[model samples]
Target: MADEITASDQIDEITDQQFLRAVTSFEAIIVSQIQVKNKLGDRLNNAIRAGIIILGIIAVSLLILLLTLSSQIGRISNVVGAMNQDFSTVSVQMSEIDTAMISMELRMKLLEGIAGQTQVMDQEVVAITADLETMRGTMAGIKSSVKGVRGNISNIAVSIDHMNVNVQQMGYDMQRMGRSARSLNKIFPFPLEY
Candidate 1:
């Protein structure tokens, strides 16, 4: 009976030790898992921070590009305005030329009336007629030149309109880019807090 009791006690002590070892092993595994979780969290934080930095750089670059494009568009608009003013000045000059041509026509008619009144100046009359024909040819050439200038101005106006449309489209694209940047900012909040 005493031997049996000692053997049972020994077996009980061995089982107790085994249970304690299993508990210790489980604690070690839990600690290891906790360390792994911390490492993964740190890696995730670093990745998020890097992504935010990259997005910030992209946003800044887009802003700079938009500003540059806006400045260039302003310069182009100023140039177009100057061209319009120049066109107006040229139109005024063309009007003055037209008035001068009318005045010259009136003077020629007066000269013709005087030459017809004196039949003794037939040679002078022929010379005056030749001068009038030359003036007519010159006026025709001036008219053709004016027409060509008007056509060129029309083409320039069309081109300006096209440029304006392109600028408007670029502005819309810039707005969309701004919205996208804002959305990105919202998705990735700043990790640092005040």
Candidate 2:
């Protein structure tokens, strides 16, 4: 009976040792699994935080770009508006220029009419100049005749009224020539007698 009791006690002790070893190994496995899960959770949290920071930076950059673009758009709109205003002013000025051109056309017609008459005026001036030369020759002949008449003062006064009439005609012609010369105030565009 004592031998059987000792063998049973030894068997019980061995079985209890095996059970404790198995339980300790299972506890160790459970602890390692919990550590792995914690590491995975930390990694996921870090990745989420990094993603949020990148998203924030991107959002800020987009906001800045939008602001800058809006500013540029506003400036472009102002420039376009200014150009439109300038074009309107230019259009008004163009209308005024058109009116000026019309006035110039009328002036050009008047100048053309005057230019046509200038030739007729030139021939009249030549005729008048020829008459002056004839009168000068007649005056020279009269001077020679007067010089030859020594002490014939009675013949020099051949009716003062007749001489006055001839002198008045010459004076009228000279006045007409003077008026024409004043109107044509050019410096020597054609052959002119001194």
Per-residue error at 79 for model 2, in Å? 1.3
- List model 2 lDDT by residue over 1-194, tens digit each: 99999999999999999999999999999999999999979865865675576567556655655665565556556555655554565555455555545655655566566776877656655655655565565556545544434223333333244445555755675565555445444422455455
Clashes of 1: 0
lDDT of 1 by residue, 81-104 (tens): 765665676566567666656766
How much lDDT does candidate 2 score?
0.60
Best candidate, lDDT: 1
Quote the positional error of residue 23 for candidate 1 in Å.
1.0
Query: In model 2, how many backbone clashes occur?
Result: 0
> In candidate 2, residue 120 scores what lDDT?
62
lDDT of 1 at 180: 60
* Residue pairs whose backbone atoms clash in candidate 2: none
Q: Where in model 1 is the C-alpha error above 4 Å?
A: 116-194
